[model samples]
Target: MDTTMGASRRRGRLAAVATVVTAAAFTTALTGCGSVDKTLDCVQTADTIADSVTDLQQAVEDAAHDPGRADAALDSIETQLRRIGDKTDSTDVNQAVDDLDRAVGRVRTALRNGDRTPDVGPVTDAAGELTKVCTT
Candidate 1:
């Protein structure tokens, strides 16, 4: 009877350990999925930002016809940047955001100073860097 009890107790303990291991594995898988989701969000936002940057370039090129379109493009880029920024706490990602933000600021400053054809090269460069970091 004592041997029987011992065997039953061992089986119970093994089941408990197995349950814990399974729960741990499930939790870990969930955490990994969450991380992948975040990365996809970031990459998608960066792609949108790239589009906005391209729009900004075109807007500047056609500034003689639509002087206000650049502002709209900048707004779009800023919104996307905020979305990506909110989704991450990575130093590299934040730095990329700051760089792009500064580039946008420079363009605005140029506009304020009566430079409608502000150079958008920096904006493009920063946006490319942002996309690269996001994919990584």
Candidate 2:
């Protein structure tokens, strides 16, 4: 009788350990899947923002010539970037958005000062850096 009780207790402990291990494995898998989704969203947002940067640069050139469209394209870019930042929950995205804002200021200055083109290198570099840091 004592031997049977000992065997039963051992089986119960083994079953309990198996259940805990299975639960832990499933929790890990779920957490990993969540991270994958977040990374995908970050990548998509980065690509969208990069494309918008191109549009904004072209729009700035047009605004320089027309003046009437001065803030229109820039405002659109700002709105899109805000949405991206909201989705990603990334401080890098926020910093890049602010950098782009400053770059827009530079473009406005260049336009008012009768310069043909604004210096956009800093803005490009900042965007690239932010995308790199945030996507990972």
Candidate 3:
């Protein structure tokens, strides 16, 4: 009976060690693929910026017919850009956000003055640059 009990204790210890080793291996494997998380984050951020730009573009187009709606859209775009700028650590992304912010500011000014013909080229160009950085 003592011999059987000793063998059972050895088996239990071995199983515990195996469990610990497996857990460590799994953790290492996940840590090794940490870059996957970073890549996903970049893609998501890029998509968000792209969507904001699209919204801004649509708002600009609608401005000729509804300046009030366009002004509201511009405000939303500015808020989104500020959030993106605050969250991003990349210099390129920051610069792109800054460029977009400036372009949006210009549009807002034009809208305030009832220009109804604000240039959108700069905003489009800045958004494209931001997308490039996110994709690559």
TM-scores, one per candidate: 0.75, 0.55, 0.63
What's the candidate order when arranged by decreasing lDDT?
A: 1, 3, 2
TM-score: which candidate is best?
1
Q: What is the RMSD of candidate 2? A: 23.4
Question: Residue by residue across 23-62, what tens digits does model 1's lDDT show?
Answer: 4444444556776677667766776776687678778878
Cα deviation of 67, candidate 3, in Å: 1.4
Runs in model 3 lying further than 4 Å from the true structure: 1-39
The residue pairs found clashing in candidate 3 are: none
Better of 1 and 3 by lDDT: 1
State the displacement of the C-alpha of residue 99, model 3, in Å, after optimal TM-score superposition.
Answer: 1.0
Pick by TM-score: 1 or 2, better one: 1
Better of 2 and 3 by TM-score: 3
Clashing pairs in model 2?
none
Q: Per-residue CA lDDT of candidate 3, range 22-103, in tens?
A: 4444444465455544434544554555555555555666666766776766676677677667766778778877887898
